[model samples]
Structure formats: C-alpha cells, structure tokens
Target: MAEPVLAAELRQEAPIPLDLGFALHPGEVTALFGASGAGKTTVLRCLAGLYRPRTGRIRCGGETWFDSDADLWLPSHRRRIGLVFQDYALFPHMTAEANVAAALGHLPRAQRAARARALLALVHLQDFASRRPAELSGGQRQRVAVARALAREPEVLLLDEPFSALDRAVRVALYAEIEALRARLACPIVLVTHDFEEVARLADRVLVLEDGRIIAEGDVGAISARADLPIIAAAAEAGSVLDATLVETLAARRLSVLDTAAGRLVAPVIDAAPGARLRVRIPARDVILADRAPEGLSVHNALAGTVAAVEPRAGGLADLLVAVGAARLRAQVTEDAVSRLGLAPGRPVVALVKSVAVTRPGA
Candidate 1:
C-alpha cells in the first residue's frame, strides 16, 4: 500500500457525535459519502482546520496539524489545503484571475499573476480569467474555483459537495475535469458527497458515513456490493463498479465488448475507441441469478460465479453477492427465488445481465 499523505483520527460528542479515522495517499481520491446530517462536512472541516474536534490528531505530509494530547493546533490558513465549496465561494467583486491570485499569498508578489494565469489555464479557464463570478456560467465559475484552490499548491485538496449545485450536464463535464486534474495533481483529494454516482465516477476509495460515524470503508466495488448496509440498500441505484477495458465495438449492434476480471461483458455502445479503459456500473436490480447457464436468453452476458453472501432485505427481496473470479456482482432477488434456486454461500451460479442494463459510471 502507498504511504498515506493525509491521516486523521477525530472524536467529538456534541453537535454531532463523531468518531472516525481514515487516511489518504498521494493522488488518491477518498470520498466521505453519506446522506445529509451524516458528519461528512464535519470531517472535511476538521481536516481543513476549520473545525477542531474535542480529541484526536491530524497529520499531513509529515506535519502535525492537530494533536489534542500535545495541545498543538494549526489554523486554516497555516495548513496548506485547497478547498472548493459547493457555492464556488469566489469574491463577487474580483475577476477569476484576481480570485485565484488571492490564494497565491505564499508566493512572491511579483510571481502571483503568472502563477494564477498558469493555474487558470490548467483548468481551461484562461480565457475567462477576467470574468467575475456573476459574469460566468456555473461550470466556468466552478473551474475558476478549482483554479483558485490549486493556486495554493496544497498538500491535500478538500471538496465539499462541489457538484451538488450544478445540473447533470455540468456535473458530468466537471467530472471529466476532475479526472484530468487528478492526473496532474499528486496531492491527496478528499471529497464529501452524498451522491453515489459521484463516488463511482471519481473516488478511488469510499468511506461510508452514517450519523457521524464511518460504518464502512473500502473500494467502490466492495462497498457497493455490500447491499446489506442500509445506505447501500437505500441508494436510488445500488450497483457494483467494474474496471474493464474495451476490446471491440459492434457499431451496427450498438454494443461494446469489454473484458473484466469476472468475464467478458457486453454493454451498450460506449463512446470510446478500442483498448480504452472504463468503469462500468452494474445495478443490483438488473442482475438475474440462475443456478446454471440458460441455453437461450435475451441477456447478452452470463458470468459464472459462486455465492459469497445472501442478505435478506425487506419487501421479500434478498441481495446476493456473487464472487465472479476476482470480481464481484450484486444481485437482488426474491426470497422465494433464493429458496427455489437453493442459493447459499459456496453455491455456483450464473449472473445474467443485458447489454442495455450495463452502463458507464458517468454516462
């Protein structure tokens, strides 16, 4: 495992009881994911030095930002962190260039302008540098905010619901921007978001928070496969994320063939050239489990796997985790179907999925 660039252990009793510990490594994006009032923002605040927990310690890049036992504390400005808020939080009177330049206080005054312009260009907002927040579109404004945050050359980047304010189209565009930024930044990025799609699209790891506590922590696939968790079960679209590489595209059929750890998968045509890597989402509800492979079916994919777990949910539904080689697939079936199929741990099964049901994470 890579060494953690940012590590924190925080505890508090009032306002919202929180007891959480996690670490982020260089170039890793760890998402603090949960519904509202889940202490996601509080954790971000604690890391940024905006909110001090009653007890615990925070360390980043070999520096102790907070140490309760040692009576050590660092103010927000003293800690090198880049934070992008949901509202953009740019000065209304200042142009995009000025706003980004304001964060270059650590550099010599003569160098601030050049660095600011460079950062703006990094975010593809160089042409909009003279526009104020009100004069720019939501997406452009967000790009400026990201540029401003990068101006600090922070050791860690903190994003608090940065996409919640934007529409789906804009959010999708920003998702690509963030992915591009990730390639250029070596800093650990922490994102606080309630959207599972956001977690699927950008996060390398997920920390599932519930009522001020982290109930689960793991990679996106593992966490999403745990349908037993209330948060996972309650998601509008509960699914497993798979890493696949496009092998072929049947343009006429409007389908794409991808190879995954589990097996070959056929998904709706993805707008990418062959050999392109992609993250695909397989919703639990769309998966159909069969004791053996069916001879003829409309399903385009049937992956062989063994049952790892069977979690019974309310409404006569049961969630099954099927271990398909090194990958896992989540399926939701009726309890009666489970009994009829004799589904249990160690049982071999075939997971049937239609091409239309499988999709790219942010598609």
Candidate 2:
C-alpha cells in the first residue's frame, strides 16, 4: 500500500470526546461521515490548521503540520491546505476570477491573473470568470470556490459539506465534475458529508464516526456492508454498496447487466459503456428474503446465499448479513418475517432484488 499523504491523531477535552486517528492517500477521496456532533468536521479543521487539538500530531507528505509534544503547529495560512466550506464564502465585491486570484497572492502580481483564469477554466468556470458571486448560480459559485481552493496548489483538499446547499440535480452534476477534477489532481481529498448516497457515489474510502470517535473505516463497499455501524443498521435508507463491472447493455429492456461476485444482476440502463466498473447500492428495504427457490416473480435478480448473521434493529426491524459467494449483502426484513421464515445463521436462502431499486450511484 502507498503511504498516506495525510496522517493525523487528534484529541480534545470537551463537547464530545475526540480520540481518533486516520490517514489519507494520494489520488483517493476519503469521506468523513457521522452524526452532527461526531467530530467529522473537527478532523477536517484540525488538518487544515483551523482548529488546533489539545494534543495530537499531523503530517502531510512526510511534513509535520502539527505536533503537540514538540510544541509545533502550522497556522492555517501557512499550511498548504485548501478548504471549501458549506457556505460558498465568495467575496461579493470580487468577480469569480478575482476570488480565485486572491488565493495566488503569494505569487507575483503579474502571474496571478493568468493562474486564476487557468484555475477557473480547470473547474469549468472559464466563461463565468467575470461574473460576481451574486450573479452566478449556487452550483457555479461552489465551482468557483473549488477553483479558488485549488489556486494554492495545496497538498490536500478539504471539502466540508460543500454541496449541501444545492439541489439533487446540481449536486449530482458537481459530483461528476469533481470526479473529473480528481483525475487531474494528485493530492488526497477529504470530504465531510452526512449523505450516505453522496458517500456511496464519490468516496473511495469511508470513515464511520460516533460520539467523537471513528468506529469503522474501510472502502465504501466494505464499510457499507458492515452491520455493526449504526448508520447502516438504523437508517431506513440503509443499504450495501457493491462494486461491479458492466458486462452488457440491454437497449430493448432499458437495462444494464453487471457482473458481481454474487451473480449477474440487471439494473436500469446506465450511461456508461460495457466493461466499465461502477458502484451499485442495493437498499436493504428493497431486498426480499426467500426461504425457498423463488419462482415466478417480477424481480429481475435473485442470488442464492446463506445467512451469515441476524440482529434485531431499531423500529422492530432486523438486519441480516447474507453471504453470497464471497460477497456479503444486507437485507432489512421484519422481526415477524424473520421468525415466520425461520431465518438464522447458516440457513440457505435466496436474495431477491428489484432492478429499479439497484441504484447506479453518481451516474
């Protein structure tokens, strides 16, 4: 494995106990997800030098950004970190180009304008360079903020709920734009979001936090498969994220077939071509459990599997971890259904999933 580009261990005294450590690698988008007071943003701020922890150490590309024992701390302006805030903090008086140029103030005055325009163009805001913050749309303003952040060519990018203010369609479009931007930048990106769907679509790795501590950390697929995480077990929208390769496109049926470890599954038509790998999220609520080989059903996908574990969840529901040929899937069934079907560990069963319910995240 490659060494992490950003590494930190942070601790705090009050308001919510903070004792957590994590690392971010280059060319990777790591998401911080949790409840409001779970210390997700705290970690981001700590890394950006906005919030200094009582005792901790932070390193970026082998350079020390903070070390409590050594009495070393880099100020926010000194730290080569780019931050995009939830509120698009653009200067109303300055045009989009000027805002981006502001970040390159350290450079020579004559070179700043060209660098600013280049950064704006990089974020697809070339034409909007002269527009003020008020004249631009929410998504456009956010893009300008992103360009400003990149103007410094920071070692790490910090995004704190940057898209929460936008509508779903705008957010989705920006997600695609950010993905394209990631391909051009080599720095590690840290995103703080409460939306699991956003995490599924954009994050390569996930960190689940609770009570100011990181309870689980892994790739999106593994982390979303975890039954122990409260967010997965308790949320009605809980689901397992799967990484599958597109094998075929059925234009007649308007569906796309993906090859997963469990089996071949068909979903609504995806925009990508065959042989492309993408993330699919199967909502637990949409999954149906069958005790016998299901026959005559409208569902398009059914995979034979064994029940690995079952746990009673909040709201009188139960979460099942089903193992299907080395791939684990989660199904949310009722306690009544579990008892009537005699569901338990080591029991043979089948998992039925609706084609429409299978979400092609970030599509």
Cα error, residue 232 of model 1, in Å, equals 0.9
- Worst window of 10 by summed lDDT in candidate 1: 354-363
Q: What is the TM-score of each candidate against the true structure?
A: 0.93, 0.94
Give per-residue CA lDDT, model 1, range 260-329, as digits (tens). Answer: 8778889878888888877888888889998889986888899889999999988999989999978888
RMSD of 2: 1.9
| Steric clashes per prediction | 0, 0
List all candidate RMSDs to the true structure.
Answer: 2.2, 1.9
- Cα lDDT for residue 127, candidate 2: 96
Local accuracy by lDDT, each model: 0.89, 0.87
Worst ten in a row by lDDT for model 2? 354-363
